[model samples]
Target: MTHTTKNDPVRAGLDRRGFLRRAGLLAGAGTVLPLLGAAAGPTASAAGTADGDPDQLFQAGEFAAAGRIYARQLHRDPGNAHAAGQLGYIDLLSNRFTRAEHLLGRAQRLAPDDMTVRRRLADCFVRQDLLARAAPLLPAAQAEQLASVDGTPYAVDGPQATRVPFLDVDPLPQVRGAVNGGAPATFVLDTGAMGLTLTTDAAQEAGLAPVSSTAVTINGRTVTTYLGVVRTLRLGEFELHNVPVSWTDGSIMAFPDGTVTAGTLGTALFYHFLTTIDYRGRALVLRRKTPAQQRAFRAEAARTALRPQPLWLAGDHLPCTPGMLGGYGPRVAVIDSGTLDCGLNTSAANAERAGIPVDWDHPIPVNGGTATVYPATAARMSIGAAVAHDVPGTVGPTPWEGLTGFDLLGNFTHDFFKPFAVTFDYTAMHLFVG
Candidate 1:
């Protein structure tokens, strides 16, 4: 079955009081109640009366309904840390960072020894760009809790992990391509990026000439970007020529740990093939599916659109525009791959001048520190041939003009091609497949 959080569409308007009453009865039946008290957050009442329905709602991804139940519980007993922590989580998911921070902080105070609360609180700091605050708590947070099982800090083990099946070419081939005539080098498969971006140093060494240039904004600042062409590019058993490349100083961050992998295979390559990233097997499989497989994949892809996008290492993009969230007019947003929800800038108007509905009745925590998020239903978004309506997103204050991250990409997964065989033809406005 497809698992979802309490925010599932089907359970939107559930009753609050009845849920809590049922939860209390369920807790009474379970012997695990006593053990849970010392675990974290709120202390069970003498009868251990808890309306477990809210907890069930949370587990089911009905975040809004779960929040309502938590609110009622908190109203009855303000000292309930469990309710507070859950409330914070709901807020965090909704992009309500400030409120989340406050509630999470309270939960931590109520249950000082609870590692889960601490870790969640730390994550909030990371989302808010307060990395320094999060660094201290990283050691205590379990890696599994940080992100999904397929996420980082874990690598595939065993012999099967060593091979990747996608490359029709040889797996470990050498290349004679250079950025500015410096030295022959090899690159690695990187499905995370949207385009082929080379480091400034690599472009300078390969003797590639700049074909054109433009400026794009990053972290609220504009930076110049260079487009160039490579005479020859090579991968395991594949090679191509006259390929386009983008050069940027930002590419340096790709090698933060300094492992000697040259260039990266980006989304430009993956779009051409049916790609599978098997994290457990430690291999990326890419194969040209048969016509039937293609048809099936396209059908499946339509449903995948609503799922959260993976926050890969590649940077994110958001279109630049003046848009309203929470009834506010024109606040800059950052298209954040790392973020699971949409957020509004703090200056956005809370009054509903546009038809947008600002969710003040249900405030959610953004992370777990001081921020809270207001939910909003986006009326429409226009992109190329795609139009999204009634999309649920968040409103928050950010330092960027706007973000074009996964919310814009919808459910499109990228394919990274071996050099030369694939190209992103911006001028032609099409992904040219070999």
Candidate 2:
């Protein structure tokens, strides 16, 4: 779901009051009544009928109607944590932050252990500019059931062991006049970056000319930098020319590994091809999609949307409100290769708290540190049609909305899904391929 402020006329097409009334009728008639006195609970038909209508409406992009149905359900069962969490989510989609917060807060109070509620509540804080409050909830959310790392519950297996198909490319070759004298170096594949970036040493070795220089911050503080254009870059079966590149002045040649990779691949690479990163399989796949494939991808994107999970404080174990990733709407997990761990904002943590098991034994290194840091364990991790067991993940601070990466990617044949379309459904917390 995406949110648009009242000032943004582009999203003001729906009538909130009318939609809410109709939703109330449908939810009461279809769901709440049937579950009132059943031994086994509501029948599948009842639940399906009740849930299906709003789901269909949501899928059809009827945001107003969907919001109303969800709202109605919440009114009927003010204590139904799931309904309340979802209602808060609706408020987020409509840019009703205050209302969303209110409903989400109520849901959390009703179900203090619900992770989904916490995730949403965290999002409310972020939207309201409460960064400090939002930061603490990330760890708990990342520790939920789905976020995985390595092949274990917390560590991600590298590409070498996964055998996922991938197109291999060396940024060095595309670099003009590169010295090519050093030993072969590896580079991290980063999707979160806005453009291509290389280490100062690599850029100098490649002999690329500096067009300009600036200061930028990474991981934390500000640093001096250089910007330039590459004459040509070749990777696998594709080639690009005169691409813009950025280089840091620091000696940080690569992630801590320093051997497995030397540079980073950013969003610049994805604009030209459909790309997939399989962390479990330790591979990156890239290919051009056909026109038909492109249409399917776009259609799936439109049909799927991300639900915001609540962010939790680092140590506090409690449910928060519900929310969704804002601008991206419906797509398989938004990739943020820049992020070090698979983190959930507060809302996701709340969702996980509600349904998934919590295992803290699994520990994984974050920020390339071996000591004094570890993430949580995930009970299940799935991407598209593939699923993995005992995934590991952690929570951390974020500047943007939400993202899915390493924790889930490590389990799949990353190379096999390249050039294919992928969509993530935050409501279902599932990934689908088109």
- In candidate 1, how many Å is residue 239 off? 2.7
Whole-model alpha-carbon lDDT for candidate 1: 0.38
In candidate 2, which residue ranges exceed 4 Å CA deviation?
A: 1-185, 218-220, 255-257, 278-283, 289-333, 337-348, 351-374, 396-399, 402-434
Over 1-434, each residue of candidate 1 has an lDDT whose tens digit, in order, gives 11111111111111111221111111010110001111222232212236556765654335577788888887898888888887876665444678989998998898887665665676566444354565455441112122211221111122221224332232222122333334655554433233345555676677655544444332223344455455555432333344445554444422222333345444434433444443223334444434654455445545644221212211111112223342333332222111222312232343244455667877664322234556666565322223345655554433221111112112111111122122222111122222
Per-model TM-score on C-alpha atoms: 0.31, 0.41
**lDDT (Cα atoms) of all candidates against the true structure:** 0.38, 0.37
Candidate 2 lDDT, tens digit per residue, 83-201?
66656666654436788788878877877766556665665554343435553453322122112211211111122111223334221111121122344344545443434456666
Angstrom error at residue 101, model 1: 46
Give the Cα error of residue 80 in candidate 1, in Å: 53
